[model samples]
Target: MPKRVDHEDRRRQIAAAVRRIAADRGLEGVSLNEVAAEAGISKGFVQHYFASRDDMLRFAATTLRGGIEERIATPLRVRDLLVALLPLDDAGRDDALVANAFLVRALKDPEIAGHFRTGHGLLRDAVAALIAAAQADGDLAQSVDPAAEAGLLLALVAGLGDAVLLGYQTGDEAIALIDLHLSRIAA
Candidate 1:
């Protein structure tokens, strides 16, 4: 019998390869040939999984977002949830690099922009919900607007990631900035 091919797993593998490339060389390094080589698969196999580079990038971006969502899915303190979004470790750094690449491309590609915008919206909404929960739990200042605070939090996280990527700040420093923000807002 022919070997059973798990399509989802194979797709994830290919996406992972793209992410590795993105981490090492930014968005410019993500090509079918590069991904195939990184994945130890044929270029044809990579093409079989993704019709084009953009498709592969979209898949990779979605995968990165899914990983973040999974991590924050469980109930946690709002501070912890925000910390989980930072690029404090290798995996998080890689995710941030890939995400940053896509975000830069989004400036030129409307479709890519839409995908990122949607993802950011989802994150913002989730953060807003968490803020509301924290307020209800008396852990955060009830006078703060959850939606506005969520937007600020998202902006700060994104800015911090950029700062870290650009060497303007270390990962630890970025996390500290976030921690400081949380402390100032604590009830």
Candidate 2:
């Protein structure tokens, strides 16, 4: 018999290791040796999955984007979005840390820039769609520009994420602040 293999699952676990590294110490600490050790795999195995640092970063950034999309697509009420906007929970905080770390690298790494641009554009479009839905349901102002509103929502989300990472406010307080923003936008 041969060893069982689940390539996609293994890749996901590797990327998750990358995300964890990024969250804890930023990209500067995500070296091949460290990731391999953290993932409990050999360095050669990690290299087999991700040929270089750029590939690993791309996977990590893409994973981060997938997480946000999953949140947006989940069957949650408009009110539920208030909770989603806050990154005060451990899961949210980790995601925010992973995302910002990727953003930091994307600024100077062209190999991974397309991955970031695509992920960010998709997230922006999803937010725009959410705004359009709110308008259609008479839950938000009719005059809202989906693009501009999406930008504002992105800014708010980013700010909240940073605050969460920096420990400026607890989860409940962050949720309350997000609630206030939602209230102003509600029709």
What tens-digit string does per-residue lDDT give for candidate 2 at 66-102? 6666566773344465467566567777778877888
- Model 1 per-residue lDDT tens digits across residues 91-124: 7787888887778888988877887888889888
Q: Residue 126's C-alpha lDDT in candidate 1?
A: 87
Among the numbered candidates, top TM-score falls to 1
Candidate RMSDs in order: 1.9, 2.2
Which 10-residue window of candidate 2 scores lowest in summed lDDT?
74-83
Cα lDDT for residue 25, candidate 2: 93
Displacement of the residue 158 alpha carbon in candidate 2, Å: 0.7
